[model samples]
Target: MALNIVIMAAGKGTRMKSTAPKVLHKLAGRSLLAHVLGTAEQLQAQRTVVIVGHGAELVEASAPGPGRQFVRQEPQLGTGHAVQHLNGDVPLIRAATARALIEACGGERLALLTIALPDPTGYGRILRQGQRVLGIVEHKDATPEQHALREVYTGMMAAPTAWLKRAVARLKNDNAQREYYLTDIVAMAAADGVPVVASQATDETEVLGVNSPAQLAELERRVQRAQADTLMEAGVRLADPARFDVRGELICGSDVEIDVGCVFEGRVSVGSNVRIGAYCVIANASIADGAVIHPFTHIDGEKLGVQIGAGALIGPFARLRPGAQLGDEVHIGNFVEVKNSTLAKGAKANHLAYLGDATVGERVNYGAGSITANYDGANKHRTVIGNDVHVGSNCVLVAPITLGDGATIGGGSTLAKDAPAAACEDEEALSTTSAARHRSSHARALSCGLRSR
Candidate 1:
């Protein structure tokens, strides 16, 4: 028996007040329907079909991967009608129907995700004849007695496939609302002597449907908390779970430390012993072990994912854009920006600066307030600096240039072409007490020696 899953996501989302389809609105970097489909995937469904109406093309593209299919519903009809539309796609889907079947047939710890509210208004009531579901009655047509029934239909169930097919066919639209009701299947199953089991969730957030931006925001928070719990279980220390947000993916290794107010979007992986400070936004990036990202740093890997090597230290306010790769022990400090650049081991750009489309070699000391002008506001170019080279403060190294090994640059020089000077161009001045001066000169290699002497 092949298992098939159908996701009802064809709603126009009139309540959402947006042009986007209801389920197309994202939750945890994926559509709400995608979340449901992901859960279905967990169940290992042989076939997963998404019902698309509004933004049909976009929805179809979102989940057309292996084992996933799409069905379109024009002029969106009722829930029962939506199920009927999938007749050709899923055969004998009774297992997708009611809770009773799951309790008797599925796993032992099987449970339902539902919640009751003080105002159980505008919802379909879950009707049970004894321990079995008789069917469901809608709010618009429910009698005074039926209206008193508080248990509402969650539009979610898992049952024997044979029963689900039969129940769906019996839905009726001969009521006040004149809308086909899937809730009728519940009563139909119960009357036919089918037993269904159900469990209730304590929080209403679990069952709340998103029909608007406000609702979407609330659901996003809940989903993020769920993700946070998973990380904490894996031994990751999160300072404040509520303040953390992950829009894409976050894969954390053991003993990772994340401070409060960090936002991780796109795809990000953090290695062990990594420390992400407060208010950091990292996207589409990978940070190796022993790396420390200071507070308020923003890294957007975008199309080209950024990679920070082991022992690297990024700024409290640095921006690492697409294609930025920092090697071991690379230090990028406050207010610096790197794009399409690779900083070799021990390279340090410790103040306000920019490095673009550049290749910096080992032990290269990039100066403060400096930049590699790799763009002509039209075409991009590259700048190459060899090992042990030293760049001076406030110097602009224009692209298509190369600074050979031991080459020294002068302070405040806007170099459109490459040249070399004595490696210790400023060794005399470096002997001064100011470490900043040593770090900002071509004699950067003498920094440690100057300190010792």
Candidate 2:
């Protein structure tokens, strides 16, 4: 059977009180509509049509990709009107649930997805006679007895395309809200002897819809908790499941332990025996076996990913930007930043340093407060440090320079030229006291006929 999926997403979401379209609001690093479309894609639907109206241009532009068509619904009406020309707002609708709905329809019947909720307020009550579903009554139009019914229509249904087209065309706007009700098609199906059937969703979360910020937040936690549970079941240890979040794909090997308040974004792979401390944010990176990522570290490899080698130790306050590659046993200590740099095995940049556009050799000790001045005004350059090089504290290695094997740079030195192997380079300027320099400057001003204040 040819399947066509229509998603109704034209609501203004006035309750959300935001200018962005309701479907555009993100739940787990992806828009709600994206989640629905992903599920639809799994169905192998022949056509997927998205109804857009509120922030139509923005929504259409921000859509994930091609293959899906968009139809505008100006002056956004009710859910029925939104999908009249072609749907529900359930972001977590699983492919299995949709398949069940389609199976219940069987190309002849009207299959409505329904759920039994503890609090079914604001939902359409499923009117039934024994096991047969008669129709659905909206919350605003139902009687007091109907309001007490816990079983409610979930606004998702599957019907024969021919019958659905005919039913929607006959739908009238004479209800309590003066809007065309998609649920009214239930009564039409019943009257036309189309055998209206109900397919109950087992999981309430799978059918829940987002209408406000609080609802979105609630769903976000639920989705994150589910992901956390899956990771834990796979032998990954999470300090606090509620405090962890994975916005994208996270693949973890055995014995991986992640602490509280950590966020893993994009695609991250953690090898076995990896320990990630609390409050770390990692994205688009790979951590090899036995790596230790300390707390408060931030790593984001946007296009060019970062790689942490085995037994590497990274910061309590370190940052690894795009193109950072650390070799085994490397130590990047507190407040250090590495960007587009490669540090060989046993390289240590401990505390308050920046290594950008640089190649650090094996056993090289990049001193505290040192930085590779890789960027001039126009272009960026690279600094090369050979094996066993020792850089003193507060030194600046200006780019387009190199430190040969076993070379030692003195503290407070700024070197622009390359140093040969086994050489000790140091700045030869005599140190001057601050008071003497101040007095000398004042005297020079007086000699130049400029009065001192």
Candidate 3:
């Protein structure tokens, strides 16, 4: 039998006090409807239909994937009326608890996902008889005696497609609320000699329905705690589980240690033995093995990601923007920012520097307070530092310039022209350092030797 999953997301969420549809409100960086859709995708149903009413256009815009179909419930009747808009022989349920119900039903019988709540107010009570679910009574319709029942319906169920259609058609708006109740179908199923079952969820949090701002906040903390537990179970050490937040997927390899107050977003992957210090925000980046990301490092690889190579050390307070790539053993020190740049092996950009649209060669020393003047107002250009180039303090290398291999750039120099291989360029005091002089002589000798060859 093919399974059709119906996600009821038409509520206006008046308690949330927002113009957005209730389902469109975010929890853990994804809309509640998105989370339900993700679980629905896992079921691989024959068709996934979304019932939209309040802010229907906005809700439709969010989940407009290839396999999704939408039906509008204009004037927003009730749950029974919602399902009445569907065709025959499909399992219909609310989106909030879709996963537990789908897993429990197995498409074999009519199953209601129920929980034993301490106070089951404002919910329908599940009626049962010796392992068989008889029906459910709404709190408004239930007598004071029935209201004492602990097991309550979670607004989630699965039934035989044809039987459900017949049952819903027979529904009447005779209840206290004067609304056609979907729970009425439970009694109908039992009367027709159909087996009604209940799937009990162990965690009430998983079946929680968000109806207000307070509920949304409660759900967020629950989700974060679950994510923290999952990572710890997989051998990733978290300093304080309650302090970690993962708004998107976080993949951690063996022996990864993340400190408190770290927030990961948008598909970050941490390699084996990587240590992330406190209060770091990393998004859409890859941290290679043995790399250490010190405290307060912010890496946001929005679309084009940042990559940290093996054994690299970055930040007590550094920012790595999109397209920043560092090779093995590279060091990016405090208050430095790198954007759209590549630093090769053993390169060090230490303290209050910026590298933008630049390519740095192996063993290049980028000094403190130095910057690559890659933007010239109208356009952006590139700066290339060849192997073994030493860039001194407070220097600015204008874009479309190159510092040749074995060359030395003196402190406070703002060089707009290219510096030749093995030469020394300084705005002032170019003849001071013996090491710079020796490099200039050796570069000249090497050039002559190469010409003779």
Q: For candidate 2, which ten residues in a row score worst on lDDT? A: 429-438
Residue 425 of model 1 has an lDDT of 40
For model 1, residues 1-453, the per-residue Cα lDDT tens digits are 345656787777788888876776777776676666655655565787777788888778776678777778876657777662222111112323323324444632212333466667766776666755556667887889988887876566555667767777777788776777765665665566665566554555555667668767877888789889999999999999998999889999888999999999989999999999999999999999999999999999999999999999999899999999999999999999999999999888888889999999998887787888888789999999888777778776767788878777756656665655334343233212334232544445443222100
Model 1 TM-score is 0.81
Q: What's the lDDT for candidate 1?
A: 0.73
TM-scores, all models, native as reference: 0.81, 0.92, 0.85
Query: What TM-score would candidate 3 get against the native?
Result: 0.85
Clashes of each: 16, 0, 3
**Which portions of model 1 show Cα errors greater than 4 Å?**
84-122, 143-148, 158-171, 190-206, 420-453
lDDT of 2 by residue, 245-325 (tens): 998889999999999999999999999999999999999999999999999999999899999999999999999999999
lDDT, residue 414, model 3: 75
lDDT to native, each model: 0.73, 0.86, 0.82
Q: Please provide, for model 3 over 224-323, each residue's C-alpha lDDT reduced to its tens digit, 9 standing for 90 to 100.
A: 9989999999999999999999988999999999999999999899999999999999999999999999999999999999999999999999999999
Report per-prediction Cα RMSD to one decimal. Answer: 7.1, 6.8, 6.6
State the lDDT at 232 in candidate 1.
Answer: 97
